[model samples]
Target: MSEENKQIAQELIDAVGGLENISSVAHCATRLRIMVKDKEKIDQNRAEDIDKVKGAYYNAGQYQVIFGTGTVNRIYEQFIALGAPESTKSEQKEETKKQGNKFQQIIRTFGDIFVPIIPVLVATGLFMGLRGLVTQEEILALFGTSPDALSDNFMLYTQVLTDTAFAFLPALVAWSAFRVFGGSPVIGIVLGLMLVNPELPNAYAVGEGEADPLMFLGFIPVVGYQGSVLPAFIAGFLGAKLEKWLRQRVAESLDLILTPFLTLLIMITGALLVIGPIFSAVEAAIMAGTTFVLQLPFGLSGLLVGGLHQVIVITGVHHIFNLFEIQLLADDGMNPFNALITAGIAAQGGAALAVALKTRSKKLKALAFPSSISAFLGITEPAIFGVNLRYIKPFAMALIGGAAGGFFAALFNLEASGMAITVIPGSLLYVYDFVPLMLYVITNVIALGTAFVLTWMFGFSDKMLEEVKTE
Candidate 1:
């Protein structure tokens, strides 16, 4: 660690009660989340005032001190060096599960399940966007070929690159959910695969009436769960619980065979007969509602979604939006959701930069600058948690900025070909058209500039810096 980081780490340890009060220490993307034995022992204000500490808050029995990305890991290492008990993410999760209320535990479970699976979707979304770009008429015209005239092998390659993840999405969801719920991921994956078996008609094909659903017991219809999420999650949860129950009852010698066998058989039957149909209907309803909201007149949908999207992120349920975006891409080949989401993300960056420019403390500036840059490059957690949300007015200004940008995006009917990756990288999703591309740029500029100007005008002051320095 750098000398500066080491100094900041020692200061942080002192501010948080010199390590004695901390039961366990862990770090996430941008914060040192410490479970303290006694919250009263820590100097919360002093922690927030520390050089590298951007903000501090207590939530769900953990004291989270914002340190911003690379800095957090170093601080965490420093804690370990100081003999603090290190905690893994799973352990922290279990701690929260034990301490939090039912709703909080459910949200935490969702975060645990989805956080690990997001990278796969993000990578796939990027490939999907690039595939759209390469196949666009303008790009293809450069190669002197129309869509029909493109080489079959080239199209085959693109299909392989882009379609595989969506085709097997259920398995991915099931595996992650199983891991989160404390079940064997391999068994979960097998159960997920069975839901999407080749023997059954594909979900999309069934929807399009191109194939028939399989009849079970003369009347119950069963279809493959291709591109589905909810059924897999439900199946994984029930399967995990069932597996545990079976393990407790069955003899240890027979557990290896009977546990998985019964878990698969019972879960698969339940999925096909109950979970799939019910949750599929529920998912359809949600998609319809989201589509209707986004389609509202005069850009109202965009304004509302863009302004409050980050609030959803704060609640840790934003991963649910992934399902909506993926469904939009599957059904319509366009995702307006990405444009609005980008507006919100860009606004956060703008607000953070404003705070960076306004703050007199070199430490605050250092923390805010890279986080702003990260936000523009399609990651906003550092910006939001480390800077903007730390100050209430900046967050509010960012929301207004996002609203303005989103209104424009909706007015232009701007859409992206992919679900993930925003701001500069999001441009790839709009490469098919020059108008949409320019609109994307304009949206980001409006978001960033508005937030920057608003924050500069009202978000920060000399008084706040004086207080920090004194602390």
Candidate 2:
């Protein structure tokens, strides 16, 4: 290990009351999460003062210290070299259940289930964006073909790339939910398949009055669930629960065969008759509510959501937005949330840059500069947790910038073709439409410029950069 890393490891061990007092140690994307045997024995202020440690807090029964991203991984390596037992993030989360509140647990649960699926969604979004670009009249003119002619020959290929994920989205949700809930993943995926079985009428076709639903008992209307989120999520949850219950009662000798048979039969019945129908309606209601909020006149809703999003990022519950974005994309194939939220993110980066530029202290500059770049890359943890939030005024300036940008986005009806990215990389989402690309650029530039100018003017001062001498 390097001399600097070794020293950091020793200081961290001491900050948490020595190695013996630590129950476990793990690092997430940005924080070093450490479980302690006794909370009183640790020194939070000292932990925060550790070199490269931006801030520290106790949440969900773990002392989480912000070390940014790459830096945290290196420091974690040092902790292992110092004899701290390597533990999984799942292990830390399991222990958190004992102390985390019901609300926190629910939010964390959603986060866990949704985070794993982002890569697929991001890829799908890119496909859709590309399709939009190629179909544009301006682009197609260069190829000596029109959108209609291209659609006749190449639309099926586009559908395979872009539509396949949403066509059977339920299966993916169920498969992921099952794995997270500790049930059989194969069983969960199979159950999801049944929801979108080819035998039943398509959900979209029925919604458009083009196909009739299958009437079970001649009273309850039933149809296939395609591109649905809640139905699949709840089905996975219930399937896992029912499977576990069956396992407990089924005899050891017949367990394998009987458990699978009983679980499938019962889950299918419950999904079609009860859970599926109820949750789909609930999901529709939620989608409508979200649309209403985002559509509120003058971008008031965007202002509120954009201004507060980073604050919630600190608590790590921002992953909940993944569900909402997915549902929105399935509805209209457009994601206003993606466009609206970027303003706050860009503003945070701007505020951090302002601090980096204005600070005379080399150490402070060193920390804030890279954090600003990280924020620009769409992960704001380093900028928000490391620098902006540490100084109250910069965070406040970022909020104003975020709010202004969000308001403009809403006013102009700016939206993205996909979800799960923002800032620099997010430019890909607006590729299909010239207007969106232009509007997206203006919104974020306004946010960044507003924050940078405001912060450089008054939000930050040179006096705050003074370094403390140590023995």
Index of the highest-lDDT prediction? 2
Question: How high is the CA lDDT of each candidate model?
Answer: 0.84, 0.86
TM-score of 2: 0.95
What is the per-residue lDDT of model 1 for residues 83-149, given as tens digits with 9 covering 90 to 100? 8889997788678778767876777777677667767666666776677677778888998877887
lDDT of 2 at 167: 83
RMSD of 2: 2.3
Alpha-carbon runs more than 4 Å astray in model 1: 1-6, 330-333, 467-471
**Candidate 2 residue runs with Cα over 4 Å from true position:** 40-42, 68-70, 465-471
Distance (Å) between predicted and true CA of 284, model 2? 1.4
The clash tally of candidate 1 reads 0
C-alpha RMSD for every candidate: 2.5, 2.3
What shift in Å separates residue 311 of candidate 2 from its native position after superposition? 1.9
- lDDT per residue for candidate 2 within 1-471, as digits (tens), equals 478978988898998999999888999888888898899998865775678876677777888887876888999888988988778998888888778678888888888888888788888898988889989989999999888777555888888999888888888899888888888999998999999998989999999999999989988878899989999999999888888888899999999999889888988888888888899999999999988899899789779877888888878778789999999888778899987789999999999999999988777788789889988999887787677876778999999999888888889899888888999999999998789999999999988988999999988886654422121
